[model samples]
Target: MKRIHDSLIVQTMSRLLIPLAQLFALYVLFFGQYGPGGGFVAGVIWTTSMILTFLVFGLKSPQGRLVEKVLHGDGVGLIIFVGVGGLCLIGGGEFLNYANLEIPGLDAPARRYMGILLGQIGVAVDVAVTGISIVLSLAYHDIEQEYHV
Candidate 1:
């Protein structure tokens, strides 16, 4: 079977669509809490775009290198997610309670909003990185089998 990266049409469409998909993912990430989408949906959208790029451009592509650079971001995301809850504890509230998040300039409602947003961002980052890592590992396994490495 022919590899997907050999198709010029697919390459062109992927190059065009990847950025748009990422932008839409951001839109979903931010506005999701207010409406129909959320962190999980945003993460899936972003990961799908990365997967499309990987399939169309191969593992040596620039975007693939970028993914490698960010492979450790899952830990950072987890930290952010946990840190928000920790902040709530510091503010004299129970774990994961957004209402008690204390910021110097924000009132209770604003602090809660910020806490929720931060938690969502953390979840999105974790999910995106985890998904990309899985895809990369699978691709590496395929390459190893092909080359008997």
Candidate 2:
């Protein structure tokens, strides 16, 4: 099989398409509550873009360093997700009960919307980070085996 980086067409297309894919992922993430797409779809799309970038640029490249930078995002996202639920509990409701979220200015419906959106955002972030981490681990393993490290 032809290596992805060895194909000029593949490299050029991936460069051109990665940004567009990520943008679409954002759209899916934000509009998910009202539409067919959601955090998981968006996260998968984003991860696909990152994978394409890694294939084209190699893991040592600047773009690939993004994976390292975002490894901690997994925890942050989990915190956001759990924090939202904890807030609901503090508001005298069950975990993840958005209707019980007691923000100062927002009413019940608005609170629900905000809670769901924030949760989805958290899920997206966590999913993206986890997927990227898995790919990075695999790549590192391959490298290790290749050089017998």
Candidate 3:
């Protein structure tokens, strides 16, 4: 991570923005119980941070490699989706029904909320990686519109 003083606007913004994104993501995660902005928003926010991180850090390493990282995340997201769906498949009621399902240590409503968040997080990862992949793809094939012949 680049230090604050040496950071360019991109780096500075990336560092600042990731945390802010996470803050809001968690806010949406928790606050959704009473209000709106639950799992979906949180997932989007969570994934977006990765995109920003890639932009700032240039995506050189394993962790920053959106394509590779996203590959694994896709499976993760799928598993979460299916898990929630399975809960509904059983006598648990609707998909991710926290009220009826009885899993120890996790409250029914809380569990449902958590389930929503997990699903959203999976979506966010997919979105962010897709965004990064698009950027990379475009980098390979420049439109050259700005260049004068």
Candidate 4:
């Protein structure tokens, strides 16, 4: 993609930014397990990374790359989210009860951990979609120029 603002400064900022965004997202997702975040946080985090990439790299090409990754990840995350429901049914315990199945080696508490993990994957998709859509719409307006109705 073309660099943003036609400036070396923007390019440099982006090169530094993308990874930090990802790391922060992961932190949010995992930290949610303890506080109030989870899959949604992860998804948002993914989106944020893409957005920063686009903001720094420029819209056309950068946006495409981000969208492509989001689409692919969204698909995989969605399948897993659905699959978790299937597991819930087989394991028995309402829709998402993971407690009924004997995981062979895992204890009861550990089963809960697994369930949370699965759920978070679903949440990640949600956050990512939000970020991607927001960035996409923003691309329509040229920040350096004014928009007219």
Poorest 10 consecutive residues by lDDT, candidate 3: 140-149
TM-score (C-alpha, index-matched) for candidate 3: 0.60
Q: Which parts of model 2 are misplaced by more than 4 Å?
A: 1-4, 143-149
- Report the candidate with higher TM-score, 2 versus 3: 2
lDDT measured at residue 117 in model 4 versus the true structure, 0 to 100? 79
| Tens-digit per-residue lDDT, 1-149, candidate 4 | 23355688877776787788888878878787688767886777678777767666554464546564564453666667767767767876666676644467887688878877777877687668756766665555563342231
Which runs in model 4 stand beyond 4 Å of their true positions? 1-3, 59-66, 72-75, 137-149
Per-residue alpha-carbon lDDT of model 3 for 40-78, expressed as tens digits? 676667666765665456445444564335644445555
Model 1 lDDT at residue 95: 98
lDDT of 2 by residue, 16-135 (tens): 899999999999999998889998889889988888787787655688667567776767778989999999999999999998998989999999999999998888888898998898
Flag the better candidate by lDDT, 1 or 3: 1
Q: Say which candidate scores most in TM-score.
A: 1
Q: Each candidate: what lDDT?
A: 0.82, 0.83, 0.59, 0.68
Looking at model 3, the pairs that clash are none
Q: Is candidate 2 or candidate 4 better by lDDT?
A: 2
* Candidate 1 lDDT over residue span 36-133, tens digit each: 88888898899989888777775566786676676768677789999999999999999999888888888888988899899999889888989988
Model 4 has an lDDT value of 0.68
User: TM-scores of the models, in the given order?
Assistant: 0.88, 0.86, 0.60, 0.74
In terms of lDDT, model 1 sits at 0.82
What's the CA error at residue 113 for candidate 3, in Å?
5.4
